[model samples]
Target: MKQGRSLLASGFVAFLLLSLAHSTLRIEPERSDASPTISDPAALLALQTRYRSLTRQLTQLTPSRPYIVVDTARNHLFIKRRDRIMLDAIASTGSGTILDKPGETAGQWIFDTPRGEFSVQSKLVNPVWVRPDWAFVEEGLAVPISQADRVEPGVLGAYALGFGKGYFIHGTLYPRLLGKNVTHGCIRLNDDDLKSVYQLARVGTPIMIF
Candidate 1:
């Protein structure tokens, strides 16, 4: 009976040891949902340094001389001289309307203000608007082959600054529509604003339109 009891105790101890080992094997490690942390300090510093360099390069690209900026979306103009705003005026830009010719292929004109960097190519006082073919078609008037019929006076107001390819920053007779997008492609301003822009901006003055 003593030997049997001892044998029973030994078997019980063996079973307990096996149970403990099974429980240890079933245990799992804890998990995380957060993103991985950056371990390298040098890569993070290099990214910050590149961002600062780009900002400095943008500041250097600004013009030192007087420049014109046209905001087509807002119908506004800003004349700046070396980071100072010389004039801020309400202006008219393109109407974004399409003029289509009936039964003609590739004969449509989209009246959109061209966006990019341009320069003042010419300046005119008491300017005459030589009406183009589109003007006559728009008005339902007969297209005149002669240049004399196309010449119109007192329509361009007192001053005009031509940029390039027939585009101009000019005065408009329609002063009530100064802040409206009502032009075919030109930039129109009120008399006082136009005079200010014409006098301040000279030939080769940079004009950035966006």
Candidate 2:
């Protein structure tokens, strides 16, 4: 019985040593001390939260009115509806001469389109061009040969106006030379934009110039 007890003790010792060896072989090696820690849970959450807030704010800030701006310097016209631009186009202005007058000789006249805040008092289709007496006098030219004289060839220049009694928004024959402050004081637009505005806008539309 004493010999059997000795053999059992030896077997238990051998089993314990084999188990320790197996555990050591299965263990993974330690990570290098110089390696960076990989955690960024807080930063990821913060970025997501900020993106959502920005998206909501953008949705809430849309505009609700129509705004029109004409930049004489840029020679561009812009019309916006509710913070979004609907029309962007090129336009021409008076030849920097806000007034027209006769030059030193008859048939010689200098003209300048007037600039100011004017309202669109009326819109005309197939508009007729009329020559006023002042236009003749200013150019030192003879009075128009006849009243109701729609006879001046170059006088009309292509478009006519009735804005503010004598001013106008019209088309120009010199389309190539548009985007210039070079008309007889009328605001000139490209044919397409002119048609669009003529159709869309009505009498008494406000126009402010800078």
For model 1, the stretches where C-alpha displacement exceeds 4 angstroms are 1-55, 102-105
Question: Which lDDT tens digits does candidate 1 get at residues 148-210?
Answer: 999999998899999888998988878898888899999999889999998898887778787
**lDDT value, candidate 1, whole model:** 0.77
lDDT agreement of model 2 with the native: 0.55
Given candidate 2, what's the lDDT at residue 207? 50
| TM-scores of the candidates in the order shown | 0.73, 0.54
Superposition TM-score, candidate 2 onto the true structure: 0.54
Candidate 2 weakest lDDT stretch, 10 residues: 58-67
lDDT string, candidate 2, 1-210, tens digits: 454334333333333343444443332555677543325778646655655654444334322333334566666656644336678878876565433444554553345544444455667765666677666665667886777662445433333334675777777667787777776666778778777666555564445444
**Highest TM-score model number:** 1
